[model samples]
Target: MPRSFLAVSLIALALAGCVTKPRPPSHLGATVTVAPPSKADVWQRVASAADAARIARIGSAWSEGLAEARSRGFGDEVKKEALLLRSGAALARPAPTPGSYSCRMVEIGSTPKKKVAFERFKPFFCYVEVEGELLTIVKQTGSQRPAGRLWEDDVASRLVYLGSLALGEEDQPKAYGEDPARDMAGVVERVAPFVWRLVIPYPRNGAKLDVFELTPVTEQPK
Candidate 1:
């Protein structure tokens, strides 16, 4: 072979080796240690892969579970995070004490109409109690801004999502704040108690679940 030809062949062989070099197990299939998806990722994936109805079902269950968990006095950050993921929102209000009241709700879509309920802790100004599927803590500050537009928007979005899933092509655009048709806004009247209710069978089952109360309980004795 000619010297120049031999040199070119050697260079080509070297280049081929470089191109075919083995990768680390972490970079290769099977052996790769892929990081588990985050909570947000799971939510997005559920929303994306599953049909809208399935997503709505899961969202409802998830919301219901959150209310139950939080009511049971689970103070871990994950509990709060789970609630937030289920379209839960809290408005800061000053309690009679130094603490604050957080009102949360879940918007559930069912046949005939959509149901909205307080998860627990409506008159959160006086209760430091956490029960099964409910939590009410008294805040020192008496009058803080109620969870105004923020809570309303959160609930509205939940309704919109559920509506879209249930109604399919008839899904309507969301209207936040005072608008009735767009927002389906519900008032937090003292007569009603908590802001969220555990209405409708969860997991879309035939049977109904517990009706959680958001009423504030008397301060627990230390």
Candidate 2:
């Protein structure tokens, strides 16, 4: 073979060898790579199976706590709070103006970090005047996917029970009267990003319900 051709063939063979060889895995977690070339060569052992199990447990605990709260007469409070947290007080209960308004929690997304975090969703509502001027309002909440559905074996099925329990607690007096939010306020505050409340509005007219979301004002950046 000619010297130039021989050199070219050698380069091609080297490139082929490089291409055929499998690359080693990185030290990062199972997420493949955090930086560029975000592809998985091999799943990393960032967290143990136990860790995943625990993470799942945390979500389960949250759901359980919510259920317990419902059983404790905080049903309206919890749903309203979820709505408030997902939406806002202004839109949630409104000012109780003569114009009738009805609001409810559309979605609740929470992110439970080690110390602090957030969960945001939407509070969808329909407000109408006695005269029949109806309006539907959908408010946007912040971003935070909190851990709550760990035990939800069936999202759709459990949601029915959850919806009934979370939203409707009229017959279940014991569940409706207990204040789960108030009971878990301290625990939630310790782990949650802000001060959480399980507010059962005064007078108990049952016409209005909500969970008041309160966050301590942080020092503004200079």
Number of clashes in every candidate structure? 23, 15
| lDDT score for residue 85 of model 2 | 36
- The best candidate by lDDT is 1
RMSD of each: 18.2, 19.4
- Expressed as tens digits, the lDDT of each residue in 1-222 for candidate 1 is 899999999999989888866687864555547897653343343232332344336446545654644444543533443423333342333111212234333332222232322233243332233334322232222232111111111232222111111122333333223232222212121223233222222423221122222443345323
Quote the RMSD, in angstroms, for model 2.
Answer: 19.4
lDDT of 2 by residue, 53-110 (tens): 4333434444544554455455665565443332122221221122222222212222
List lDDT for all candidates, in order: 0.32, 0.28
What TM-score, to 2 decimals, does candidate 1 have?
Answer: 0.21
For model 1, the run of ten residues with the poorest summed lDDT: 145-154
